[model samples]
Target: MAKMPVYLTTPIYYVNDRPHIGHAYTSLATDVLARFKRLDGHEVFFLTGTDEHGQKVEKAAKDAGEDPQAFTDRVSQAFRELTATMGFSNDDFIRTTEPRHKAACVALWQALAGKGEIYLGDYEGWYAVRDEAFYGPDELTERDGVKYAPSGAPVEWVREPSYFFRLSKWLPELLRRYDLPEGHPDRIDIQPESRRNEVRAFIQQGLKDFAERPEKLDLSVSRTSFTWGVKVPGDEAHVMYVWLDALTNYITAAGYPDTAHPRWRFWPADVHFVGKDIVRFHTIYWPAFLMAAGLPVPRRVFAHGWWTNEGQKISKSLGNVIDPVALVEEFGLDPVRYFLLREVPFGNDGDFSRKALVHRLNGELADALGNLANRTLSLIQRNCEGRLPAEAVRDASDAALFASLDTLLATVRNQLDQQQFHLALESVFASVRDANGYITQQAPWALKKTDLVRMAAVLRHLHTALRAYATVLQPFMPATMAALLDQLGVPADARDFGALATPLPEGTPLPPPAPLFRKLDLPA
Candidate 1:
C-alpha cells in the first residue's frame, strides 16, 4: 500500500511578544510528528511561521517606534532562528504579509463574497483589542474590578461597519459533521458530548451572525492612519482582519489560489495544532470561512492546553516566564525535549517546574538511558577492544532481548502514531531500563576473561541494540542521537527506525564514546 501523505502545522506565533516556551512547545510537538511520519515512510510537509499582522503588533510597533513590518521581520527572524537551534526541520516558513499569502487571502475573500456568503453590515459588540477578538456580552465576567474575557483580554463595547459571514446557517452542519463515527481523525478532539449538546441547545434557542472586522477599524481616518496589514484588495479603506489574515496562512503556505502547485493537493489541512484559547476561531470561524468559499474544511483542530510555571501563570510581572532558548542552552536540547514530552500528557494543562524537570532528567534521562549507553559502550571498549562483534546464534538471552525490542518498537510506533508522545517516550525509556537490567543480570563483564569469544558476541549484540535504541530516540533527541550514532560509528544516514534488528558486522571499529548526559546541579 502507498504511504499516506502527512501534513502537520504549528499555529503561527504572533510576533508582538518575544518567543517563549509556549511557542517552543507547539513547534516541538509538530517537529516530533513530522519526524515520526517521515520515519514511518510518509511524505511529510511541516510548516511553522510567525503571525505578523494584528492590532497587538501595530501597538507593539508604535511602542518600539518602528514600522510594524520592520518590527515583525526582526521578531520573526528570532522565531526562525529557534527552529535551527531547536533542531526543527519544517519544510516551509510562511509570513502573513508575503505577496503569495496576500494574494491567496484576497482570492479566498473574493471566493467567499462571490458565493453570497459575506455581506456588509453594521457590527456592534464587545471587542477586545488586546485579544484581537470580538465577544458577546454574555461571555463577559468581572475580575479584579474589570471585565475580562475568559482569555484574560479586557473587553470594550464598539460599533463598526463590518463584513459578516453567514455563520448561523452552518451551526447545525458543523455539529453534525463533527458527529461522525468513532475513530475518525476529527473525533479525537471533538468537544465533549455534554458541551456539544449545550452548544447545540444554545444554537437552537437562537444563533447570531458573525461579522469580520479589519484589524484597524475605519473611521474616516487618513490613508496613513494604519500601516500594519495587508491592503484590502482594491479598497484601501480597510485591511484584512487579523483573524482572517492569519487563518488563511494555512492555505497560503500550500500554494493557495494556484492549484497547479503540488502542495495544493493538501490544501485543506489534515490537522491544526492550536491552543484551546483560540478554539472558537479555529473550529467555528475558520470552518465557516472555508465552507463559505466552497473550500474543504480542515480535518481536525486539536486544541492543547496552556502551561503555568510552578503553579502560577507565567507572567512578565511575576517573573515566571520560561525562556526556551535559555533552557535549551543550559540542559541541552534533548533533555529539555524529553522532559517536556514525557512530563505531561498531551491535550492537558501542565506545570513547568525546575524541580520536575530536574527529577525527570536525572532519573529517566541521565540515570536510565544515559547510564545504559555509557555502561554498554564502556564494556565494548574494554572487553572487545572497541569493536562491534559479529552476530551470533539465537541463544535464549539474545532471543529474549530481540523479542523485547520487537514488542517495545511496536508499542512505541503505535503510541507515536496516536500522538501520545509521552507514552511513546515512556515506552522507549522502559525498554532502556530493561536493557540496563538485562546487561547487569547477564553480567557481560563477568564472562570477559573466561569466555572472551562469548563476551565478544554479547558485546556485539549490545552494541547493535544501542544503535537501534539511538535510532528510535532521534526524533525527540536529534542532537544526542546523532552523537550516539557517531560514537557507534553508524553512518549519518543509517540512523532510522528501519535499521533496527540489523547488526553491523563484527570488527567494525567503534568511535570513542562520550557521556550522553551530565547530572545537573541545582543552582544555589
Candidate 2:
C-alpha cells in the first residue's frame, strides 16, 4: 500500500528563554503522534524550532549586551539541543531567522499586499510587548495605578505608522468556516470542545461588534518600533508583525513560495499544535492570512492548556519553572514522557508534582508493566530453557485475552486521532493490567509441575500479548520499548504495526530476561 502523507507541527517556541517543561510537553505530544503515524505506515513530516524574531527577543538581546542575531543563534541552539535531549523524531527544525523562512515571509506579505488586503494606517492602542498582542481598552484591567492585559501582562499606550490587515473583512468568512458542523469536510477543527466553543464565541462576538464599530476590528500587521524582524515587502521603515512572521514559519518549513518543491505536498498541514494562549493568532489571524494570500488553511489547530509547578503558576520570580532537561536527568526520559501524557488529559491544566511523578514511575512503569514483562519472561527462561514456548490447545480464557489484543490498535488509533493521549495510554495499560490478572489466575508457574502442555500455552499467550503491547507503545516510550522488544528476540524489522499480525515463532531462542524499570526511591 502507498504511504499516506501526514504533516504535524509544534509551534515554533519563542527564543527569549531556555526551554522549559511546557515546551517539552507540546513537542513530546507532537513527537508521539509522528512516531505513531510512521509505525502505522504513513509518511510523516514533524516540524519544530524556535521563533527568533520579535520585539521581546530584541529587548532581551539588548539586556544581555549581545547582537540580536547572536542572541537568537545562542538560544535557538538550546532548543535544538532539547529535541535531541528529549529524543524528538522531528523531520525538520526550522528557525525563523533562516533565509528560506525570511524569504517565505516576504512572499506571503507581497501576496496579501497584491490582493489589497493590507494598507498603511496609524495604530493607536494599548499594546502588550510581553504578549506581542494588542488589547482593546475594554479588555484592560487597572490595579494600583497600573494597567494590565487579560493575561496580566502590563500594557503600554502606543501610536505608530503601521500597516493593517483587513481582518474585519474576513470576519464573516471566518465565522462561516468555524461554524461548519462537526463532521463537515472543510470544518476548521479546533480541539478540546471548550477551545472550539471559545473560538466560535470570539468570532460571533467579533461579527456583532464589527457591525457597530468596524475600525476597531482591523489588525495591526506591521510595527515601526522593532527592527529585528522580517522587513515589510516594500516598506523598510516597518517590520512585519512578529506574529505574521512567526506564523508563516509553518508554511516556510513546508516550502511555501516554491509550490513545486517536493515537500510542498505536505502543505495545508494536517495539524498545528499550540498552547491555548495563542489560539486567537492561529484560528483567527492565521487562517485569514492564508485566505488573503490565496493559500490553503491548515485542517486543524489543537490548543492545549498550560502546566503549573506544584500547584503554583510557573514563573521566573517563583523560581519553580520546571526544566525538562533536569527532569529527564533526574528521572529517565521515557518515564518523564510517559508521566506527562498519562498524568492528565491533554487539554487540561496539570500540576507537575514530584510525588505524582514518583508515583507513576514506581506504580505504572516499574510495578505494572515492567513486573508483568519480567515475570512472564523469567518463567519462560527458567522452565522452557530460554526459548519461546510452543502453543497448546487453547481454553476459553485464552480466547478472551486474544480478543482484547486484536482490538488494541484500533482502540488506540481512535483516541490518538483526537489527541487524547491520556485515554490512549489508559487503553494500553488496561491491557497490561488484564495480562497481569491472566497470569495470576492461570498460575503458569504452578501449572509447570502438573500440566506442562497448559503451561506452554499460557506462556505463549502472554508472549503474544507482550509483543502487541510493546509494538503499540513504541511511540510513547521508544527507547524502553526497543529494549523490551529486543529482550523478546523480536527482529528489528518486525516491530512495526504489520508485524503484530505475525506472532513470535514458537521455540525461537530468547535472550536472558532483564528488568525494564527499577522502582524509584520515594522522596523524604
Candidate 3:
C-alpha cells in the first residue's frame, strides 16, 4: 500500500547571526513532526535551511574582510553544523545563494509579474537593514539621537525605485479563508488560537491600496537599496526582496520551476513551523505571495514562543545565549531534546535554567524512564535466567497497567497531529509513572520467594510496559529510546511503530542490562 505524503518545513535560519537556542527550538519542533510522521508510515519530506543573502551579509563581509558569498558560506555552514550537533534529521538543507534556488526564485517572480499582481514602483520609508523590514514614522523610536525599530535594530531613511506586489487586491479573499470551517480544503489555519487572532487583527488594522500613496501597507517586493539577493527576472537593476527570496525557499526545495517534478506532489505543505516573532510573515506576506502565484498556502502555520534565560530575554549583547553545543555536550542529546519539548507547552514561552534541566534529566528521565528499563531487564535476568517469560501471565493489576498503555499510540498520534509536543510527552510519562507504581506495589521480589509463576508474570508486565514506553518516545528522544530497545533485546528491524504492538518473543536472550539515561551531575 502507498503511504500518504506529509511535507513539513522550518523557517530558514538567517545567517546574519549565529544559530542559537531559538533556532534549535524551531528545528526541534519540525524534526519531531517529521520523525513522528515517518514512524507513522507516511512518506515525509522535511526541509530546513539557511537564508544566506541580504544587505546584512554584504556589509558583514566588508567589515570582516571577506567577500559576501564567502562570508555567507561560512555562516551557513555553521547553521548546517548546528543541525547535526543538535541531533536533527532534516532531509535537505538549502541556501538562498544556491544556483537552483536562484532559478526557482526568478521563476516565481516572473510568474507573479506575468499575472499582473506585481508592478514597478517607488518606496520611501524608515528601513531596518538587520530586520530587512520597513517601518513608518510612528513605528520608529528615537533612541539617544538615533531612530530604531521596536526590535532595537537601527533604522535609516531610504528613497529608492522598487517593485511592489498588489497585496491589497486579495485582502478580502485572505480574510474569508480564515472564516472557513475547520478542515476545509481552502482554509489556511493559523495555530495557537492567539496567533490566528493576532494575524487577523494585523490585517484589519489597515492595508494600503496601490491607488493610495503606497506607503504603510504595500510591501516592497524588490529592493534597489541592496543587490545581495536574487535578481529580478528582466530588470536586474534591482534585486528581489530578501524575505521573498527566503520564502521561495520552500517551493524551490519542492522543485517549483519544474512543476511536474515528483517533489511538488508534496505541495500545500502540511505545516510550516515558525517562531512566534515572525508569525506575521508566515501568515500574511508568504500566503499572499503564494496565492498570487497560484500556489497553495500551506495547510497550517504554527508559531511557537521563545525561550528566556532565567526571566531575561536571550540576546547576544546580554552574553546570556544558551549554547546548543554546550547543552548537548554537558547533557546527552536525548536528555537535552527531551527537556526542550517537555519543559513547556508547544506554543508558550519557556524559561531555561540549569536547575530545571538537571531536575528533568535526573528526576524524570533517569529515575522514572531509565530506571524502569534497568529494573525490568535486571529482574528478568536474575529471576528468569536471562530469558523472557514465554508469555505475559496477567492479573488484575497487570492488566490494569497494560490497559493504560493501550490508548497511548492513538493518544500520541492525535497530539502530534495537533503539534502538542509537551502533551504528547506528558501522556507517555503517565504510563511510565504507572509502571513504576505497579512494580513497587507488586513487589516482584516478594513474589519470587512466595510464588514463582506470579513473579514471572509481574516481571513480564514490567518488561512489556518499558518496551511500549520506549517505542512512543523514539520521536522525541532518539538516542535514549534506541539504547533502551537494545537493552530489551529488540532488534533494530523490530523497533518501529508497527512492531510496538507485537509482543516480545519468548526466551529472547538479552544483553546485560545497562542504564540508558545515566544520572547527570550538573554543578549547582
Candidate 4:
C-alpha cells in the first residue's frame, strides 16, 4: 500500500535576530508532529527556514555596517544551525533570498495579476516597520501624540507607488470559506477554540468593517521604500511586501510553480504551526493570497501561545530572553524537550523557570519514567539471566495492564491529531505511573525465590508494557527512547507504530540496563 502524505511547516523566523526560545517552541511542536506521522507509516515533508527579506533586516544591516545580504546570511545561518542544535528533522530549509524561492514568489505574483487580483496603485497609510504591516486609523492607538499599532509597535505614515492585492474583493469568499460553523469539512480550521473564534469574529466583523469603510481599501502587496525583498514580477522599482514573500515559502518548499515536482504531492499542507502573535497573518492574509492565486490553503493553522521567562515577559530590553541552545546544553536535549510540551497546555501561555524545569527533570523524567525503565530492565537482567522471561500464563492484573497498552496507540493518535501535545504526553506518563504502581504491588523482587514462575510472568508483562511506552515516546524524546528500545532487545526494524502489535520474542537476550536520566540537584 502507498503511504499517505503529510506536510507540515513552522513559520520562518525573521533573520534580524538570533534564534530564541519562541522560535524553538513552534519548531519543536512541528517536529514532534512530523516525527509522529513518520512513525505511523506516513511519508511526511517537514519544512522550516528563515525569512531574510524585510525592512527590519535592511535597517539592522545598516546599523551593523554590513550589506543586507551579508548580514542576513550570517543570522540566517544561526537559525539553520538551530535545526541541527535542537535535533529538528525538517526535510528542507527555505530562505526568501534563495533563487528558487524568488522564482516561486514571482510565479505567484504573476498568477494573482493574471486573475486581476492585483493592481498598481499609490499606498497612503500608517505602516509599522517592526511588523511589516499596514494599519488603518482605527487600529492605531494614540498616546502622547504618538501613534502605535495594535501590537504596540510605533507606526509611521508612508506614501509610495505600490501593487495592491484585491483583498477586499475576496472578503465575501473568504467569509464563506472560513466563517462556517466548526467541523465543516471545507472550513479553514484555525485551532484552539479561542483562536478559532477570534479568526471567525475578525472575518465576520473586523474584515467586513475594514472592507466597507469609507476608504474601501485593498491590501498593499508591494513596497518601494526597501530594496530587501523580492521585486514585483515586471516592476523593478517595487519589491513585493515582506509578508507576501514570507508566506509564499510554504508552497515554495513544496516545489511551487512546478506542480510536476515529485514533492509537490505534499501541497496544501496538513497543518502550519505558528506562534500566537502571528496567527492573524497565517490564518487571514496567507489564505487570501492563496485563494487569489487559485491555490489551496493549508488544511489547518494552529497558533500556539508564548512562553514567559520566570513570570515576566520575555523581552530584549528586559534581558530575560531564554536561549534554547543554552537550555539544551545545561540539561540533556530530551529532558528539555520533554519539559517544554509537558509543562503547559498547547495553546495557553506558559512560564519558563529554572525551578520548574529542574522540578520536572528530577521529579518526572528521573523519578517517574526513567526509574520505571531502570528498575524493570535491571530486575530482568539480574533475575531472568539478561533475557526476556519465557512464556507464562497471565493473571487478571496482567490482562488489565495489557488491555491498556492495547488501546494506548489509538488514544495517542487521537490526542496528537488534535495537536493536544500536553494531553498526549499526559496519557503516556499515566501509563508510566501505572507501571510503577504495578511493579510496587506485584513485588517481583520478593517473588524471585518463593514463586519464580509467577515472577517471570510479572516481568514478561512489564517488559511488554515498557516497549509500548518507548514506542509512543520516540517522537518526543527520540534519543532517549531509541536508547530505551535498544536496551529492550528489540530489533531496529521493529520499532515503529506497526511493531507495537508484536511482542518481543520470549527469552530474547537483553543487554544490561543503564539509567536513562539522572536526578538533578537543586541549585543552592
> RMSD per prediction, one decimal?
4.1, 1.1, 1.8, 1.5
Q: Could you give candidate 2's per-residue lDDT for residues 248-284 as a string of tens digits?
A: 9999998989999989998888889999999999999
Spell out the clash pairs found in candidate 3. none
In the range 93-204, model 3's lDDT, one tens digit per residue, is 9999999999999999989999998888899889998888887676689968999997789999999999998878777688899879998999989999999998887677
Best model number under TM-score: 2
TM of each candidate vs. truth:
0.91, 0.98, 0.97, 0.97
Model 2, runs deviating above 4 Å: 391-393
Ranking by TM-score: 2, 4, 3, 1
lDDT per model vs. reference = 0.77, 0.92, 0.88, 0.89
Candidate 1 TM-score to native: 0.91
lDDT (10s digit) by residue, model 4, range 222-340: 98898988988778899999999999999998889999999899988989999988998898889889988888888899999999998999999999999999999999899989899
Better of 2 and 3 by TM-score: 2
Point out where model 1 deviates above 4 Å.
143-145, 182-227, 398-400
Tell me the tens digit of each residue's lDDT in model 1 across 1-524: 86778788899889988888888888888898889778767788899998998778999989999988889899999999999888899999998878898899899878877887666666666778788877666778987877888687898777765666667666666777667786664442344233345444544444433224232221111122355777665566667778888988998988888878899776567668777677667776677677777777787666667799989998999998899999989888888988888888877789998888888888888888888888888888887778787787757777756666767767878887666789998878777777777788778889875887777767776776777778888889888888888988787666666666456766888866798888887644
For candidate 1, the per-residue lDDT at 5 reads 83
2 or 3, which is superior by lDDT? 2
